[model samples]
Target: MKVLLKWLQDFVDIEDNPAQIAEKLTMVGLETEEVIYTKELFKNVVVGKILKIENHPSSDKLKICEVSVGTDTVKIVCGAPNVEENRYVVVALPGAELQGNKIEKVNIRGVESCGMLCSEKDLGLAVHSEGIILLENSYTLGKPIYEEVYKDLDDVLFVINITPNRGDCLSHLGIARELSAVFGKSLKKIISKGPKLIGQTKEFKVIIEDPNLCRRYTGKLVKNVVIKPSPDYIKVRLSLCGMRPINNIVDITNYVMLGYGQPLHAFDYDLITNNTIIVRKAKKNERMVTLDGKERVLDEKDLVIADTDRIIALAGVMGGANSEVNANTKNILIESAFFDPVSVRKTAKKLGLSSEASYRFERGVDIENTPIACEIAGNMMQNFADGQAVCGVLDTYPLPYEERIIKFRPSKCEGYLGTKLPAEEMEKRLENLKFGITKKRFEWDI
Candidate 1:
């Protein structure tokens, strides 16, 4: 699991350096497999804005442009299809080095080129066809693009090797809780309680035919949503966290999952057949094409969410393209549920579809935190996407899992550590890790 430092800050406040934290986390059970320093990848790239663009005197495909790189304006020769005047872009100045390759002044077709403009492909970011990404106008001109794009560029990414028993550490919040225990601090959670509903949600129906596969399924309908690209800040955060922003609704779900470790799915309400949701085992020859446009055949052991006509989503794995939120969608159904770990794993493996949500569900999550996470997603959708909750929730939970209780003995802990810990010290550490005490026993309600 790759863990970024910025994501870690959401749970606990650690003043230690990256190396120190990595060393500490390694010494404990969670071993750090690798440490990636992304800032060093782009050393001397800076932000620049196009001041003027003119047709090349000699070549029909080439263009002459004047770009401002903070201190002064320089004339550059370019042939990109999307070069426009007065657009902010990334500029790699002369004498600058990227990925150890030194950029130098050059002459192109009798035109003196002092610097070169960059694209996502040129910067080795990713494979893309969009003419150099038009940066936000708010970014200051001539500022180092790497620094502006990654405020915490020096942050370290720790690839943690987690064991099957350590499912709780799969999420940012879960890692935070472990860090709090190791550092003797309290972990905070960004949890919301309730949201406003503009209409009654009872207009739709929710049915769970197989309680063994789905433990609990909760859904809320939101109306009048605007589907647009996410803001720059949101896009940057998602990029840094290794996700590409899709749209407002999808981005909100990704943000909530990264923040709280709970997976959420948004479905277009109008596209749902018969305005009903059915959670049950897949039919003998059920088939669906996921959002990624890959067709998958399902077995009887697989679990799926079906409308009256066809299967709309692979439960706990991915949603179908037919019910996906689109630009014309005015209403959405936000799904937050707990699927049996065994069922999710079996289905995902059978369909050859293992997503971030399925990976977490297969391991296990804090089942009790489902409602709080749903509320967080709902609030973000309403505030960021201009969406409104339009109904009561549709919750179907036939059976709830019992909370886990662990018993700890002070002498046993000290003996296991091969050191004698004071009784007060043991109690303090356990309390700091969010364990409640009753009589001489402590329990963790996971």
Candidate 2:
């Protein structure tokens, strides 16, 4: 699991250097594999403003343009369809190295181009971009692209080696919680207030047919959404953390999963039949197409989220393509549910459709986080996708987890760690991890 340093700082006061923090975390069993300094990746790349643009004389597909690199205006050859004048773009000067590919001045179709205009893909800022990315006017010309585009690029990526049992550390918030205990810092909580719905009405009905497999399921209907590209900040963080941003709705779900350690799924509401969601075992010979465009045959052992007509998603795994959120999708059904870890793992492994959501589901999400995750996604749907969140959530938690209090002895702490830990110290550690501690005569109820 990769943890971004800046994201960590959002939760704790990380005054120690990344290497020091990594060392501390490693000693505590959260081993850090690598601490990458992102700023050192780019060199000799500057923000350039396009001075003029015209068709290349030698080739119809190519265009010749003059760009100001803050110091000098150089003629360059470009071919991006969105290349426009007065827009600031990343320009690779001669002798620049982009992902080990040497960029040098060369002539393209008789045009003497001094440098190359770059896209987000060229800068390694995104998986793919349609054309050259236009920078905001705040970016000054003749400045290094690294300095302007990545103003807060002083980021450190902490590649943590998470054990299979430590599924909670798979997210940024989980790691931050750990750091809060280690560093005595407060874990920042994400507070998303409920939105005033459109007439406080919804259109979907959810039923949990098999509560044994699905512990908790929270679904919400967000209507009139515009699926578009996510903001640059979201895209940049996702790209740096090894996620390919697809669209606003999907990206928001991915973001929440990364931040909260809770996996979320979004479905096109209009595609669901009878406006209903059912969580149950798949019927025999039932087949559903995933977002990857492949048909996956399901077995009776596999749990699935289905509408009245057909399966909409493999429960805790991949969503069906017919119900996937896309550009044309105007309404969405956001799902945040906790599935049985064993059942989810079996289904994901059997179908060969492992996703980030499946990975967390197979491990297990915090059972209490289902509704919180739903609200977070619903808020994002409103903020980023221009959607109106329905007033209430469709929570189908037929069997909520009943808390069982466990007894703990302070002497066991010293015996297990082979250290002289006082009773107060043991209480502090348990309290930091959010265990509810109730004191009796000489024992603690946890």
Candidate 3:
């Protein structure tokens, strides 16, 4: 799991640096594999504007561009088809290194190219791209690319090695919670209410066929959503966390999942046959094509999310291509749910389909976070996609989570740890973790 330092700051105010935080997390069983300082990799890379574009005299495929990087102007040879005059682009100046390749004053086809025009792939921000990254007019010229993406050029990324049992720590909030506990700090609370509903709409229905397979399912509708590129901050954070940005709708779901550790899915509302969602077991030999364009066959033991006519998603694994959100998508239905760990694991293994959602589902997610995550995604859609959320949430929760209380003795706990811990300190730690405590004469109820 890749955790951004700035993202963690949303939940806790820690005064430790990256190395110190890594050590502290390591002491608490969350091992940090690597710490990436983005500033070092983006050294000397700045925003530049294209002043002139001229076809290379010696080569037809290459064009010579006069780019203004703030105060200085330099000539660069580029071959990307999307290059245009007056557009802001990423420029790697002399002495800059990209993926270990150095940019320098070199002649390309007899033309002196003083710097290099960079694509997202060249800067290691994306795995593939056809053209150089085109920045919006909001970016300042000659500013470091890192400064535009992150508040501080020194934004750090922690590549954490999460064990199977620690699935709860897969997100920024989860990590922040651990940091708060380890450092004896309070975890900050965030408000996640969606836009005020215009009153309940009878547009959709949700059903749960079995309580054992699916514990809870929550959904919200956002109408008239504009499908467009996400804001710079959302795109940058997703990229920094190793996810490719698709669109505002999809990115918002992924963003909420990353921030809260609860995976969400969006279905194009027009594609839902009956405006209904049914969480139930699949029939034997039923097949559906997923977003990846591969057909998967399932049996009765497999769980799925279906509409009246057909399956829309392989439950907890992946959404179907039939209900996929696209450039023309206007109405979106967001799904946030919890499935049985064993059921999700079996279906994912049999179909050889594992996703970020499946990964979290198979291990388990906070059952109570389903609705909260849905609200967060809905609010993001409202703010970013020009969407208006419908008032009520369609929720089917047959099996509600029951709180567990474990009784313990302070002396026994101290004996297990082989330390001298007072009961008052023990109660303080448990309170910091948000556990209900009831003190008794001889023992404590937690």
Candidate 4:
């Protein structure tokens, strides 16, 4: 799991430098792959403005562009579909080096290009680059694009190799909690939005028939949501975390999932017939097309999130296309739930559909965060997506989570570790991690 240092700050005040912080994280079992300084990769790359665009006489998919490259205007050939006049983009000068590829002046299809117009892939900003990289209008034509993208001036991208057992560290908040435990720092918790949600009026019902497969299911309804691109902050966080910015409504679900270690799904409320949410095992030969546009065949063992008519989502895996949120979607149902890790893993493996949601579910999500995550996403839409969160959540947790109690003998700390530690020091670490301490005659029960 790649944790952005700035994003981690929202949960804890981590003052340590990246290397020191990385060493501490590695000591705690979350191995550090490497610390990525996103800005240091590209050399001689700067913001450029497209002065003019003309169709190439020889190639239909190509175009010739006059770009303003800070100190000078240069002619370049490009084929990006979104390339247009007066748009700012990343330009790699003749001496620029990108991904070990030495960018030099070259003639393409008879046009002598002085520089290369960059894309997300060309700049190593994203996994796949579609069109040219579009810069915001706020970016100055002469300024370096890296300075704006990595706007904290400097960001520490800690790429940690999270083991499967550490699903709790899958999110920034989870890692912050771990860091708080290791460093004995206070975990900065974000205050709940606490919006005035209307009570459940039998308008929405979430029935969990197969509680063994699904531990808990919670959902919130938000109406009049306008689907649009998320703000720059959300886009940058998601982009840096390796997610393409889709829209505000969808982005909120993704954001909170990263903030908390819980995944939330959005459904087009209008398509949910009879206004119901059903958590049950799939019927024999159940077929549905997921958001990926691929048709998947399900069986009786697969858990599903269904409405009055048909399956709306393959629970804990992906949402169905028929009930997906889109531009015309005005009302949405936000879903946050805890699925049986084994069931989710089996279903995901059968369908060959592995996603971030499935990854977390297959490990485990704190069941207590179900409704909390839903409420967070709902309130975020009201603030960022121009929507009103319909009060109350339709929560159906058939099998509640049982609280765990562990016995710890701080006096024997030296036996577990090579170093001797005092009981007060050990208790402080647990207290900082929010573990409840009950004093016993001999040891502490937490």
Taken over the whole model, the C-alpha lDDT of each candidate is 0.78, 0.83, 0.87, 0.84
Best by lDDT: 3
Location of the lowest summed lDDT over 10 successive residues in candidate 2: 192-201
Residue 35, model 4: lDDT of 95
Model 1 over residues 272-324: C-alpha lDDT tens digits?
98999999888887789999999888878888999889999999999999998
Estimate the overall C-alpha local distance difference test score of candidate 2: 0.83
TM-score, predicted candidate 3 vs. hidden true structure: 0.91
Worst 10 residues of 3 by lDDT: 192-201
Order the numbered candidates by TM-score, best leading. Answer: 2, 3, 4, 1
Q: Number of clashing pairs, model 1? A: 2
For each candidate, what TM-score against the reference?
Answer: 0.87, 0.93, 0.91, 0.90
Q: How close is candidate 1 to the true structure, as a TM-score?
A: 0.87
Please rank every candidate by lDDT, starting with the best: 3, 4, 2, 1
Question: Which one wins by lDDT: 3 or 4?
Answer: 3
Query: Highest TM-score among the candidates is held by which one?
Result: 2
Point out the worst 10-residue segment of candidate 1 by lDDT: 191-200
lDDT of 3 by residue, 333-391 (tens): 99999999999999999888889989999889999888888888888899999999877
> Clash number for model 4?
2
lDDT-best of 1 and 2: 2
